[model samples]
Target: MPRALLLTLAALLSACSPRVLSAEGWSFRIGDAAGEVRLVSRQEFGVCSPKLVGCTVPLGHGCLVMLDRDYFLNGTPRQRTLLLAHEVGHCLDASVLEYGHGGIGAQGAVYGEYYRPAVEGFAESYARAYVAVCGDNLAPLGYGSGPACALPDPRTVRVSLP
Candidate 1:
């Protein structure tokens, strides 16, 4: 192949390749749908938005979870996995509501107080469940002192879809 063609092919192949993360007998891949979610989140939040330091944005079929380079470099493997799993939970519709938003007064109160917490709780529960199931494998990864290992009761998680 011509040099230019070879370079172009390489770029194309790279673009088509899925983003993958693997550890402790668990592996995850972000496909095209998830890539779109990440693009949207990057556009909306920009790089390292303080507000989105540790947040998840759910798209229709997927979600974008932010984990700054600092966290990836400094956090324990367990923390990294827990964060990813929590966001994955959101992508998988673990929350009662499809999205979180509300106005003031009674409805707003529900949206602000109840809705957001329910979703967060659900996501945390999902992460915790994963940790519980894989505790033996994940323990060495430094998940010893986090919410991932000590998850809340799923029954307590309220869900009011809108």
Candidate 2:
């Protein structure tokens, strides 16, 4: 094919590219905990940087957000969903700090381990609690900072879905 034809083809493909849904500082509530989801990536994971698999960028009051969307991982749909929830957890934690609200991470040691930082613990615990509410006790263990596992009972924890 000629270069001109190739360029035209590229332009057409780019124009037809599907748009990915994204939100900035989207507010949400899970049970008694309420906060904004800083960044929620649905089909992609960790698209922010080339080196990162995933991350949460914190802006004042939490607006600007970027995650590691660099490369494709051999992640299954279920695992990607978990990663998405984890990133949402980061957003929730960021809002809690800015707005002075009682988000899920406020409960120290309840959702996270003492050895790690609160931010990571927040994401990890939020993921666990998310799965807890869904009753996914059979989820694969040894994920996140605290070796995250689903909580014992769904009734013990409250989760809000929208």
Candidate 3:
């Protein structure tokens, strides 16, 4: 194949491939349901703070999950998977609100707190559960120590994916 054709093919293949977020002993595949997962710098992870590790932005149909490349580069596979799972949980939970569960910005309603510890707790629990189900040896990183899989009652609406 010509050089240009080869480059085009590579780009196309990359576009079609599922984004893989991997660490030392574990890896998670970000599927089409999540839209796109971008690995960015800490400064890019959030607004005015290069120290943030990850974030999730909800899109109409899917969502965007951004990981801090620097954090992951220095962290263990367990840490990476834990953070990725937490962000994914945020996206998944937000989907419920986007689908007209309660109303616009229903996630805030469910959070129902000054700092939204409940929301963070749920994400942490989700990460713990996911790691357990996958049978990975790594211990829960952040909120895993709090609850096993505790999600707020108000935010526990059923979501059907197609």
Candidate 4:
């Protein structure tokens, strides 16, 4: 999709509510920190399956975000931030490296070496990489040292703002 269209969608998503803004901020920051590859939200990811979480589709263009109302409202800010970052990691996986063209079968495997484990492994690796460089000091945002807060390379994941 065109960058302009993507930005427009992001703006529309952000305008949905305050939660969207917060989520967008997290996505933007993380994307910028990681360097290269753009991250944005879509209205719907086009696939709804049990295997994928947080609007993850195996088509692999980017992640489609859906902030659960309960989590956004009741969960701590740190929790929300981590969740957003995690989902964004999945987006990065789709758009950049593993842009799988296969549908549900290729996307969601029931029994194979290339299914759940590989997908989660890649996502976790990306998250860990981000944390390692960025540090877990999201304290200013009222977040504490969660799993993502203790990264080792707090410098590599910095994304440049446009």
Candidate achieving the largest TM-score: 3
Q: For residues 11-38, write the lDDT of model 1, one tens digit per residue.
A: 4433432231211122222222231112
> For model 1, what is the alpha-carbon lDDT of residue 22?
13
The Cα RMSD in angstroms, rounded to one decimal, for candidate 1 relative to the true structure is 10.6
Clashing pairs in 2: 38-91, 46-68, 46-69, 47-68, 47-69, 48-67, 48-68, 48-69
Q: What would the TM-scores of all predictions be? A: 0.43, 0.40, 0.51, 0.43
| Winner on TM-score (3 vs 4) | 3
C-alpha lDDT values of all predictions: 0.40, 0.41, 0.47, 0.40
1-162: candidate 3 lDDT, tens digit per residue: 233543343344344332323212221223323334566665544432455687666654345566777786678868876787767666655654443332223233343342135455555555555665543332322222243333333244322211
Query: How displaced is residue 7 in candidate 1, in Å?
Result: 22
Q: Residues 1-162, candidate 4: write the lDDT tens digits.
A: 345545555465445433343453332323322211222233322233323334433222433355454454465654555554555555555665453311122322333343345454444444445444554444322234444444322222322211
Question: Order of all candidates by TM-score, from best down to worst?
Answer: 3, 1, 4, 2
Off by over 4 Å in 4: 1-46, 49-53, 57-62, 100-116, 135-162
What is candidate 2's CA lDDT for residue 29?
35
Candidate 2 global lDDT: 0.41
What lDDT score goes with residue 159 in model 2? 27
Location of the lowest summed lDDT over 10 successive residues in candidate 1: 18-27
